[model samples]
Target: MPWWVEYGRSFFPVILAVFLLRSFLVEPFRIPSGSMIPTLHVGDFILVNKFTYGIRLPVIDKKVIDIGVPQRGDVVVFRYPPEPSTDYIKRVVGVPGDRIGYYDRVLYVNGEPVTERVKAQALREDGQEVLRVPEQLGEHRYQVQWVPQRSSRQGEVVVPPGTYFVLGDNRDNSKDSRYWGFVPDENLVGKAFFIWMSWDSQRFAVDWRRIGSAIP
Candidate 1:
């Protein structure tokens, strides 16, 4: 045994154990965009349940254990397809073999329009062009925003097996499958279920209302 290895033998297991714990358990992430707005806000600290999907070797992203699959309405954090180092948050809109379409700001799943009843739209004076769209997705209800007259990314996509389609609640602002492509099942990190805190220098204050809120 190398001197360094023997010197830390007593603590080697402890160090490796911590690595295994974080690799297969919960991981922390900070929200950097409004893509998941209302559900998760900028600066909000979040915890992702890694084992909910399956167990994958860290860094390599190869699943070694088959635990289960992602369910509809689950908010997830994943690596951006174009940039793996960067992480993104979005709601699972279409699962494997599901047909997903978007037109006129409405979502259609499997050839049927997923119902969304608009509640209200807010025009913020911050010049960011944000309009909130609150709707009930089956039993799960949440608010998303549609930027006025900014509907640019529009199209239809059929999710393929071993891949999932994701969309941001800030539909008009999010760069998701609509722009890039489907997220490989292996790329999924975990489900995001809470908003621990939020802050934006542009907003200039901590959003107390969002604290401790359960992500819908």
Candidate 2:
């Protein structure tokens, strides 16, 4: 075989394998915004389980295999409904056929208020008082941040079949389902499971404590 042909044959399989793994197995994503603050911080690099919610063909995002469905409270990454080419991460607040509501920083599912308890208080970068609270949605319990004094949008809507309602943990700052709309099942990319690394750009340092932290 020609030298060039031999080199191409040797590397093609390796490249193809990596493409399949990332497309159908797992993928890494960076948190680019503080929408999920108190849970997922900006600069946190997370690994998502691509197969957790079933396998889908890459690019097209059409599911070809059945595996699972996103549950309430599961942190997920999906193509932004309004802009399918962009990816956004948020916590699932309502699954198919559920009524979800957000009013005055409180969350309600199916007309029953989700349980939450204040955990701590801290000042935001803007010097606003923020409350850290543990909110329970189904079997998942995670902390969410709330700035009560900040004006926030709120409303109620019934999630249609094959769609999900999601919200960012940073209640007042996030532009999520409360703004754009529900995430279609086809738009789902995967469920975020781990924070493999974190970098603090402002301090120009690696946050050692956030490394290897599992996404709640």
Candidate 3:
């Protein structure tokens, strides 16, 4: 065999193995927006556990096998459906087969309102009043904000099987499932659980307090 051919055969499999391991084991992500603010701030560097949803192929995003399904309240990173190369991070509000609804800023799942209570009302950096919902989803309780008078993207969506609906904690500013559509199981990249670092260009400094914070 030609020396070049012999080298190619040996090198290809080694390259494939490394790519698969990085894609399925852990992937690095950078937060580009304030959609998940408070939980994940803009400029935060995060690591996503890719195999948590399932073992998906890199680049193509095909699920050849299944590991498990997403549970409600899990923070996830995935490809934006309209633009696959763009990535997004949000909380899983509805899983496959869930009946999700948002009416007048209240969230309802399976016809039962996901109970919420007021935590605090505050003004955002943009001078908008935000109503914070400190609600329990399963065993997890996290804060989500709603801005009164701001047009809310409201709708009732029956999540199809092998898909999930997600939203951001900064609800009003987020372009989430409410805007685009459900995230396919295959599109899932992984669960984002921690922030290793954060920096805000506007502030011109590192957000030292956000470093090492867990993504709720």
Q: Which candidate tops TM-score? A: 2
Model 2 CA deviation exceeding 4 Å by range: 115-120, 124-126
> Number of clashing residue pairs in every model?
0, 0, 0
lDDT string for model 3 (97-205, tens) is: 8999988777899998774745555666667667767766886778887777788877899999878999888888898899888998767788888888888888999
lDDT of 1 by residue, 1-216 (tens): 898888799898998988887799978788877777667767888778899999998777789999988877788988888888888889998899888888888788888766464655667734676666665555577777777767557678889999999888878778888888999987788988777777766779888877887778
State TM-scores per candidate. 0.84, 0.93, 0.84
Model 3 TM-score is 0.84
Q: Is candidate 1 or candidate 2 better by TM-score?
A: 2
* TM-score, candidate number 2: 0.93
What is the Cα-based lDDT of residue 119 in candidate 1? 56
User: Model 1 Cα RMSD, Å?
Assistant: 3.3
Q: What lDDT, from 0 to 1, does candidate 2 have?
A: 0.89
164, model 3: CA deviation in Å? Answer: 1.1
> Candidate 3 clashing pairs?
none
Model 1 pairs whose backbones collide: none
In model 2, the Cα lDDT at residue 2 comes to: 98
Rank by lDDT, highest first.
2, 3, 1
